[model samples]
Target chain A: MSEGTVSGAALRILAAGPGVTIQDAGRHGLLRFGVTGAGPMDPLAFALANKVAQVPDGSAALEISMGGVELEAVDAAITLAIAGGNFRVTLDGQAMPSAARLTLEPGSKLSIKAGEEGAWCYLAPCGRIDIPAQLGSLSTHTRSGIGGLQGRALAAGDVLPLAEPKVLPGGAMEIEAPVLKRPGDVIRVLLGPQDDYFNDAEIAAFLNGPWTVSVRSDRMAYFLDGTPLTHAGGFNIVSDGIAHGGIQVPGEGFPVVLMGDRQPTGGYPKIATIIGVDLGRMAQLRPGSVFRFASVSLEEAVAARRAEAAEVVSGWALAPLVRTSLSSEFLLGCRLVDGWVDALAED
Target chain B: MSKPLIEGAIYDAPRFLNSGETALVVEFGRSVEPEISDRVLSLDAAMTALKLPGVRETVPTYRSLMIHYDPLVIDRATLIAQVEEIASRPGTAGGPASRWVLPCCYDPEYGEDVGEIARMTGLSEEKVVSLHSGATFRVYMYGFAPGFCYLGGLPPELAVSRRTRPRPPHPPNMTLIGGGLAIVTTFSMPTGWWLMGRTPERMFSPQREKAFLVAVGDELKFEPVDRDTFLSLDARAAAGEVVARREALS
Candidate 1:
């Protein structure tokens, strides 16, 4: 109810994947109440999809994963972009590129298939998806059912209106995908407050093991099957607040990588924390993928994050620009502070 | 209603845990003690007052406090140093907290596990209700679920172990007891804890300007009410009216 934008034309979601939810940045500063910060699994992908759509900063979008989504634009035309996970999209019997910004004419049927690579993809409209904000965000924490289109996943016949619709002069313009890769299955981590809980041998086992992402994975945490980390001391520390990406090793010994919708606090011993820079890279890794961990210092983590932030803003991984049958140019000759098409705008 | 008294400090220096590049945990001790909880709140108060750069938010628990921050704005060393300095300050003591009186209906229809709780505690049903409601509880932490506070201060005589089997899906606002602890859940959750009574009050609602009904360091004393009164209060609560009564603990 405290959302900023007013709704316009509606987007009818005809079908969706398992992990699909509406997400913005996150619901922050509420972890004290045990509310996890639920946002896009891949913040870079979320940001890129918004950039491709050329929507206002912090616009809410639908995140699809595992499977895909089928939707139709009802009553009006709007700009749309599909980014992350390299999903296969088909627009009304015609195969279309997934990451390109395109306009959806009224009654357009768009079907999506899961990406061959990553786990989550973003469906960002040039207009914000109209959903009531819960705790100052549209992001859905599906486990707790706190946010998104009525605090759950979108199914068939969910009519989602645009917060601010851009009239039909929509077109396709693609940006080079930012370099989000970390080369292979290695996940970078910072040694923890509870690293001392485990002896040197346990730490070595953690760094030198081939971990597999379990099927039990969700936005909350990824339960990994790897070398069990034996606690030198008690596995149960006094319960404490969890940082994003904190890894908890319970008495069972297996590590659970806490994700976006993780519990705010826990009693398990955390041996390490994954750096925020590679969280998306880690999230994109599919179940059964060989997961590995590498230790890094706090200074290294911060430096890597700074580099990633620069790539998000300055990287020219944009695909070539084009106008589809229903396309309009939102980036060209507009009041955007930049007011110019990002580099490599063509065709 | 009475509050949990704060005992003297037990630990000399707090233990620090690096939660991540963005967070740090200051732990006073492992066991649950009144003084440890007090120190957690006091350090939380002190840290918030410092307004340390890059410090985003702090979560206070019974034995520790987790500080979430933005590393881009502040370095880890600077944040840790600032927290240590602020924590060691003489004025880092917390102020008194409020006392909240919650209503509980111990009728069998609402409290499906009331008989089970009584059997587990080896007490008669009437005696169980009186003993459970009569005791004053301390708000230790809010976690596992939103607005779900860890209520301590259960008397040893009425203490019992958690159920070997948990309920499939437990409803919210039920006064649950297990492992010598009591909780009035804010939302429906599957729990190993036993449901002794139900209340109509909403401990947390997203619509409210302030979401939490009771914070950590507060006291929650349950007042037994009839099913009719519970129904009326539930209706009033649904209409966005305040039902959980609070008073100064002076």
Candidate 2:
């Protein structure tokens, strides 16, 4: 609806791989209307991609899970940034950089291989993707059949329009990255409203137990296969509002961690909530990956979130660079950012 | 006779159940009942009207209203106190009630489980339909899914337990009876309720100028119709006709 023109550089989806959807910050405050805020599972990575592209905070990005996507650019030149869990990426047979901005030319084929470590990846392009916003959000709620590109994922031959390029001063800037483990193990949590439901022994077991992320996991909830927390009271309670990262203990006792795109309300007793700062780490843990929950006080959770937020805000303060010249060699050299270099050096 | 209001332990300052760094659940009651729902709804209405600073939104359920706020703008203590003050205010009675007529098709084709419901209630299919259409039921809450109305005051003779195993997928607009109550589904949700009939009316429409057809505290009466009438009414509603109307209970 913004006066942005549709560009000729269309993305041709060659593989149309598994569970790739366009996501943004998600629609909020519509739960009373039974609409869940369906967005990227890892908001941290999504925000990081936007910051790298210098796109606005709520700009639409491709949420590609388990990779295996191949797309060819059609016409216009665009700046694209890739972030989130480690993934194998290649552009025209050369290795592409993750967590770095790259200038993509017309007819260039960008291929993302399967993710070896993380569960999700984000692809954000400069200039917001043009799509109809439903209920004040462009993020897709696949269950509710609204938002995104016709409320669905990108399929083969889908031409999504990108806004025209504007010239900005400077070249591509990459930040000094922090060292991250391939698959993060410990997920930090804060005690919840129903923490008293479980006794000292059950609480201790829950914190110390190594829970495998069950295959029944999705954007709605992650079913953890681990120790069954005993409850003196029954599991059934009055149905109540559920928030993202709320650890719900159903009748079976295995905790189910509610996630983005979860139901607006549920009845299961929630024992705890994963801290906001560690939610990204939890989201990246692939199914079958084992994780231990570490309990932290409310104060500690707030402090961790503030520390992360401060880092992101400072990261965005660095200005983004725009490219004027379009030589293939120059673009290739730029694609060899620190992330790609680190991976190659390790190899 | 009205039941006496049982006052629970009152908290001058609202307590927070740490949900996450960004969100917390501000619980009002521990049990689910009409009085609890009333308190929750009152708090919900008061908060919405106030439009507190940094409060993104509040969701009212049977007993609790989850207030989601921007932690950066407002701290937990301020929000809890604001909600507590609103909840403690006198004369914050529950919302008023309204009467509504719901036309339902009782044909076996649409009401797939009518025979099962009749068997469970020990009444004939026609008797079951008549009993369901005979009374004006009070709506207790609107939840479980968008626009799904949970109604009370079903005839005791017609009262029947829900199916032991829930249907994998219950149809939208299915009139279901369970636990001495009846529910009209606004969205597709799995249910153990005995499905007696179906209505073509769109109970929940996010795109509509008025999103929900019925709210809490509304009285609903089911009017049985044949398949032909159901089809015509569906068409009329699709054409933007206001077929749903309210009338005095017969």
Candidate 3:
């Protein structure tokens, strides 16, 4: 009810994957009440998707996992931006780039399928989503089932109503696929609030790890598989508050990096925390991919985060999409159709 | 790997652990106790009162306070200094927490693990129920799941290690015990604990004015009820009534 004005635009999920859910900047101030902030897995990618759609920052958007989703514009034409992960997409039989923006004519189908890289994708519309906020967030924490699309994943036939758009006039646009620095690069970490619990050898094993991302990974935590870590001090710690990217090593010794939807508090000792700038890289890692961790100073982590924040707000990544078939000069000169195009017209 | 400067002063004073670049954990102690919980909650209240710029949210747990803030708006050193000063100040009393008397039914049908628990603890079923219901429990904090109330002060006799194999999804609203801790589940979840009884009182209801029924520092005592009375209360609670009764403990 606290959402904005409805312009009657809507989108219906024709098909969806298990992990698909609506997410925003995530619920805040409720962590004390045992609520986790279930924001997008890759905050950088999520923010970029919203920027591409010209929606306000942190607008509610669909988080598509590897299984992908099929949707259709129902009531009226709506502009959408797809970002994060290299997902195969087609708008009504026309193949589109993995990360692209397009106006879906009413009744038109849009399909996004699994791509070769990345584990999560985002689909954002250029309007406010009509779903009511729970505890001041649209981010769906599926474990608790409290926010977004009835606090659950979207299923086939679920309709998403939209409010009036901020900027509706734009043609199809696409961006280059996101590139990773390296296949097995070092992810920076800050050693623990509980590092003392582990002896120097265990800490060395953690930092020197070429750990594999477990198949059991989800929004809650990414379970790493490698040499099991034994606690020097006992496994249990007094249950304490956990933050996103806190790497908690249980008695099993395999570290579990807490994600966006991690529980507010945990009983296991946290060995280290992944730096903010590296979290997106960690999130995009496909299951079975190998990675390592390197320790960094607090100053370095802060500096990296501040720089990344500036880049996100700078609109540096966004550029007008140019179709390969049409020359940039030709496409810029021509005035694309602003309103609905006749389906029967010849190209 | 070289430790951060923050870790150097940790041993000398309160342990302030960095949680990534955005959050810091102000640990008051190494174990769970009323004094530690008191310090954590009081600091949480005092910090919230300050309305410090860039402080996004704070999670006050059993032994530590984790403050989530925007590093872009507030630097780490300044935030840590403010917390240390507030923590050192004397005589910050927490508001009186509410004491709740929630109705629970320990019938073998509803409390599926009651017989097993009695066998494990070397006590009769009636004695197990009496011992559990007799103790006055304190709410340490809510975590692991939404509105899942983690209660402290379970009787030593009732305490047992968590099941080696966690059971598949158990029904919600059960008063469960394990690993020296007690919890009233708000939703159906796979728990490694022993289910002692079922409660008609909902610990969490999204539709309710207050979604979370209990708060940290609140005192709770379970009142035994018969199967028929539990059924009636369950029906009433499902219809949106707050079946649990409470009064401020001044």
Task: Give candidate 2's TM-score.
Answer: 0.86
TM-score per candidate, chains pooled: 0.88, 0.86, 0.92
RMSD each, Å: 6.2, 5.5, 4.0
Where model 2 places Cα greater than 4 Å from the true spot, the runs are: A1-10, A164-176, A179-183, A316-347, B1-16, B121-131, B134-146, B149-165, B179-182, B187-189, B246-250
Please provide, for model 1 over B59-176, each residue's C-alpha lDDT reduced to its tens digit, 9 standing for 90 to 100: 9987888888888998877877876786677744454478888888989987787787667768788888888788888888888778788888887766787777777777777888
Best by TM-score: 3
lDDT of candidate 3 over A1-347, digit per residue (tens): 11233367788999998999999988989888888889999887788888778788999999999878999877677778888777898877667778887777676789998888888889999888888999899999988888988789999999998888433443666654343222436889999878988888988999998899999999999999998988876788778988889999988789999998999899898999998888878898989999889999999998988777766666344345433486666654443323213332446
Superposition error at A33 for model 2 (Å): 1.9
Q: Write the per-residue lDDT of candidate 2 for residues B163-240, one digit (tens) a residue.
A: 767787777778888767788886677777877788878777666787677666567888888899999998887766
Q: Per-model i-RMS in Å?
A: 7.8, 6.5, 2.9
TM-score of 3: 0.92
Q: Residues A225-301, candidate 1, lDDT per residue (tens digit)?
A: 97677888667665778887899998889999999888888878888999888788888888898968899888898
The best-first sequence of candidates by lDDT reads 3, 1, 2
lDDT of 2 by residue, A31-104 (tens): 76556877889888888888767778868888887845777666766667777777777766666445555655
TM-score of 1: 0.88
Docking band of candidate 3: medium
Worst 10 residues of 2 chain B by lDDT: B1-10
